[model samples]
Target: MAALPTVQAPGIVNLSYAFTNEGNLLYREDSLNYQKEVFAYDELNRLTGWDIYDDSSIPNEEHSIV
Candidate 1:
């Protein structure tokens, strides 16, 4: 995988990643580091929404299908 440009919005940091061979974006991670909210996408390249994780990487809350 390759790291792409990182776009910073109002309250979120958008990180894009692409495949090494196909150059297709495998997924993206959107996060508010302050809030510990992270959103993960799938191969379809859509926003599968977020899961709240603490510093320990434990899932606290999740939002999907949005």
Candidate 2:
């Protein structure tokens, strides 16, 4: 299957993403918001947790899945 390009909302010109060899999303960055989202996977490549950072004002914002 062909990989799809990442899409963002209108007027959001600064956006990027990173993926693993298995096509797993590793991280996403949005320069307009000064934020970055990171993903984590387990041995089986299953989503384990994730973290988000907002450098605009707050130090960091994190979220996890169990």
Candidate 3:
């Protein structure tokens, strides 16, 4: 799990990550705030859904890929 830079609001530190070999982003965290998100993908490398976790590390919301 490597951290990738995020281009969100200016001066806002955000961190995204992906699998080393698959290059699939599995999770993202806001370095300047409390936002933890997870991304899911199908076998074909297509996005399936996404899960949002609160600061407590509990899933709070989810949305399917369109």
- Tell me the whole-model lDDT of each prediction, alpha carbons only: 0.55, 0.79, 0.75
lDDT value, candidate 1, whole model: 0.55
lDDT of 1 by residue, 1-66 (tens): 445556676765654333434454433445555335555566766667766655446777777885
Q: List candidate 2 stretches off by more than 4 Å.
A: 1-11, 56-59
Per-residue lDDT value at 54 in model 3: 76
Write the residue-wise lDDT of candidate 2 on 1-66 in tens digits.
355446567785678888888889888888788788889999899998888888754438667778
lDDT for 24 in candidate 2 is 94
TM-score of 3: 0.68
Q: What is candidate 3's lDDT per residue for 1-66, written digit by digit as tens? A: 455556567675666555525778778887667778888888888889989887876789989987
Candidate 3 residue 66 Cα shift, in angstroms, is: 6.5
After TM-score superposition, the amount by which residue 45's alpha carbon in candidate 2 deviates from its true location, in angstroms, is 1.0
TM-score of each: 0.38, 0.73, 0.68
* lDDT: worst 10-residue window of model 2: 1-10
RMSD of every candidate to native, in Å, equals: 6.2, 3.1, 3.9
* Residue 58 alpha-carbon offset, candidate 1, angstroms: 0.8
